[model samples]
Target: MRFKIGIIFIFLCQIAQAQQSEMTVNQNHYDSEFKANSELISEFENNGKSNAEFRLIAKSNDNGKISVYIQNNTSDTISLSHQDYSIYILQEAMNKNGLWKPIEYWESSDCGNSFGEIKIEPNEIIQTKSTKYSGNFKTKIRFKLSENNKVYYSNSIVGNINPNKLILPNDFSFTWPLAIMENIGKKTPLELQKKVVFLEPNGMEEFNEFFEKSMNKKN
Candidate 1:
């Protein structure tokens, strides 16, 4: 009896240790790498193309994982979490032959069965998982043709974010034999796959268009 009890205690200890190993990232993981070019900012305003402002809003602490958000200069309240923001991390190619890479995305993994929406007033911020983890931005670079048929890039690009998603449970594991097998290839609630886009002067329209399509599909 004594030996049997010792084996049981050791097995329980292993289970507890395994459960404690799951880790989330630090607050800094939610930072954005979306840097707007000063020249582009100036050129857009000079050309009378500036209509709105785009910025990131994030929150984190030792008690919780970081949450990321986007603030837009608009007039209506927006429901963002439902939209699942997609991010595009932009890479600069030296010879125009460099390939673009995917952005670093983040989002809430644990969601209760209850669902609620946060109302974002105009010019208010809405949340995104992509921003909460870590991010990379992709700008759609545009170049102008001169009269000499030469390509002169004002070195500016327009970028946009798009959304795709999956709905899953928050729990990462179910040690029960059947439970483990049942969840194979399933998505987790924390799995958010939305892209947060940075709009150049001309990207606003496309962003709105993408947003509208996302809503339609959700409905």
Candidate 2:
């Protein structure tokens, strides 16, 4: 009995060590990839102005991932935002104000300190990491990429908001910001929040109505 128990203990220890070794290998690979992608983004930031033939193509994969493919037509390498975080604006349809208002409140927590970017080699086409859309309205929505205060718009894609459908990791529920809550009918400025949250269509309407009613009573 003693010999059998000792063998079992040794086997368990070996299994634990094997799992730890695998985890270390995976972590190293992730760090390597992250460093590689960051370096590409830096190169573009430094020399992107000299290139003018770059193009941004938006694509939605079957996995509900929105990927922006950047085609570098210049002879030099260039970098651009990965479009995987809150780097792009979610614009609603053309309203009576003739302005495309940003209605997206989703922000990524995975990106810390700086948004992710990737370097595309000369004539190389690279796609960004997957990004999820959270707009609950059934309007024509588009992604807008801005650099140097100039906006670059993507092709419009329309879909209804599915609160049950989780398109992002670690999504939560939170109250709308005062900027959006106060300016219910008006166009709100493009402000990025810290965490991404999903709300049902009716939930948004109910909250907005409550906010408006409370404000009217105060007035």
Candidate 3:
């Protein structure tokens, strides 16, 4: 009877451990998305020029509008010197053969509108409405500095775009380098290191194919 009880306890412990692991994964994904958004907001506030730090807070409304909040954490006021900002929504796609393809990029400006910029005071938050895009996808918000369009600071919030639909898979099994090796002819060592950390070794072909398709389109 003691041996049977021990086995039961072990099985329960295993189940608890598995549950904890799944929870940790979910929390990590949430934290990653939050951090990405925060980084983008900081870039916009500082315009890649100021040393002050900022953060982003993204909240989804029931009416399908995403409200992005920009806050200044420092004691001094931070100014976002941009006239207009833009938000891009990327949808995940699957090929006919049941393989996960590259992300489909859609811009809010393409829909004939854009988000305006606002000044964020110290210890204050400014909110802006986000444009809607189709499918279960992630949000990448960018704030462009008025001085030079090419030197824009960007941040991506990783979450499901379609709140009504099922959650999208968050597996990092795809390798982007193999798919775009021809495009990245002379990559820097730092770029190579980032690729190694982000992409899976065996999924290069799949990553490249999806990237090619996505880039070729106007959306």
Candidate 4:
């Protein structure tokens, strides 16, 4: 019995060692491929020693819409706040009245309040539907990351808010910044712009009625 147990332990050790060796080899290959990839337009490292890396790239599809892909480029796993992905109007992008507020948006899969861990192994990519803004709106994204029960923030991206083309076959209803949309309609200042959140048509009627009434009271 002792001999059999010893043999089993040795076999388990061999399997673990093989896995670690394979992971090391794959990591080296990923580093090389990442350096050679030309599609990567920009990259960002975590402000601190946190081993999280981010990459941004854009591509045009057959439908004539541009798809902006955000990539994770580190060996360590990252936990992201899935719900607080907002389209923040940069300080330079704010106007005199401060009409633009950070528009809160959520994906269908990310609608619930949950802490999701993003484990994009080296050389892997993840995709999500970005906020569809209109006009010349410059913007950035703000969210939270978790490490050892402590939360850290990614830096505010400084760049143009690429207009993601969202087309509807019918008259889609949307609610933008009330101070901006109710007052200025679509005429924004030359510098500052608006981000509209297109509500799904399923509960459009009820939501619009309730939301408009609530805003009227607040105003």
Candidate 5:
């Protein structure tokens, strides 16, 4: 009986030590990478004949301010229609069980008329604040584009903040302009466009098969 009691005490000591070590490791990981409960999301695009590109990046500062970047990637004149553009941000929080929950949303448009119908010449990028809307972060970020009040393109970006890394949950996808043109009778030759890249959850092999069948059916 004495031997068994001694062995049980030793085993309990070992378990306690292991638990302490695990807690230390978790704390160290959090200290190195985790931000104080904040996240950002943004999107942008270029509408030019050539390979023009635009990007919108968002960052959450320590003081609860969100900064936005509108970057242009071409050396030619680029005209931006502010009426056709908008920016949105969503904030989220983690619960005690580590599940992410939506907190709020923010949006901006026109910049109080101080910026309107803006035009950025080739190679010029603009950075501005979204003064039109402000709220807490929500669960998703959506960017939309339109012409004459009709939506021409839209994209959705989803991610969650983990320690010091922003893990992108999936690949970003853009609607093909050819599909839009076809809807408007813009002379889009369906036969010339042979491949369609579907960014859905389905695998690439399935997407390719579907594309082939759709084209065959149309023909």
Candidate 6:
């Protein structure tokens, strides 16, 4: 009986040690990611474009698609790259809690040769492209565009169609890094992809704060 108890105790000890090791590895992964995200956020704050005069607007056309337009109120020409102009922009939904979450609009490989630029001359109001929202989610939805290494958001419109059902859980939240990472596989810029962080559970407030601070454009 004494020998059997000794073996059981050793087995338990091994199991405990293994679990502890796994947890340590997970924690280390999270720590590394957090540190990397901090660095990326700092870099973006220093270099990301902040043209308050630029206006991004979205309106439902007579057709089923939403037409997006970029009004260049800036004095300089704006160059928007990543070729499929409007396809990869994120379709964001406002949850019941008033927090925003992204519902992906396009699904395609980003490893393409779509590095071409589309220039909008000064004082030009150009139509970038249109997106068809085919989902069943009815909420206040908006478009988030990352073009020319700068981020711009559109005015909110009602969204009742969410085809892919890509909506996040009610408890889920939004962060710029998380939103950018979710769209990384879908033709997002390589520079932004390299700086993305995993989805944060409660970063909605922080995300809005960052947007407000960086681009305070009125809709």
The model with the greatest TM-score is 6
- Once superposed on the true structure, which residue ranges of model 4 sit more than 4 Å away at CA? 1-37, 41-68, 77-101, 105-118, 135-219
Over the stretch 129-185, how does candidate 2's per-residue lDDT look in tens digits? 434443344545455554433445655665443332222223122234445445442
Tell me the lDDT of candidate 5.
0.34
Q: For residues 1-219, what per-residue lDDT tens digits would candidate 5 score against the true structure?
A: 999999999999987554322211101000112222222212233333434255445444344333344444567665544422332222333433556432222112223553345455554445433211222322333322222222222132343322211222121122233443343222323322211221112333444465566667678
Better of 1 and 5 by lDDT: 5
Candidate 2 regions off by >4 Å? 1-53, 81-99, 105-117, 129-137, 162-219
Q: Against the correct fold, how does model 4 do in TM-score?
A: 0.29
Model 3 alpha-carbon miss at residue 166, Å: 18
* Cα TM-score per model: 0.27, 0.39, 0.30, 0.29, 0.28, 0.49
- lDDT of residue 46 for candidate 4: 31
Candidate 3: regions farther than 4 A off: 1-52, 85-117, 136-219
Error of 1 at 157 (Å): 13
Better of 5 and 6 by lDDT: 6
C-alpha RMSD of each candidate structure in angstroms: 15.0, 14.6, 16.8, 20.3, 19.3, 19.4
Pick the lDDT winner: 6
- The global C-alpha lDDT for each of the candidates, from Candidate 1 onward, is 0.32, 0.44, 0.38, 0.35, 0.34, 0.48
Q: What is the lDDT of residue 211 in candidate 2?
A: 55
Total clashes in model 6, counting residue pairs 3 or more apart in sequence or in different chains: 5
| Least well predicted 10-residue stretch by lDDT in candidate 4 | 23-32
Question: What 10-residue stretch in candidate 1 is worst by lDDT?
Answer: 143-152
Evaluate residue 90 in candidate 2 and report its C-alpha lDDT on the 0 to 100 scale: 38
lDDT string, candidate 6, 1-219, tens digits: 999999999999987554322211011000111122354334334544655645666767676666665555579987654333332355566766888665542232244564356566775555544544543457887876654335568779987653344432232223223544353223433323223322222233454454455444432
The window of 10 residues in a row where model 5 has the poorest summed lDDT is 23-32
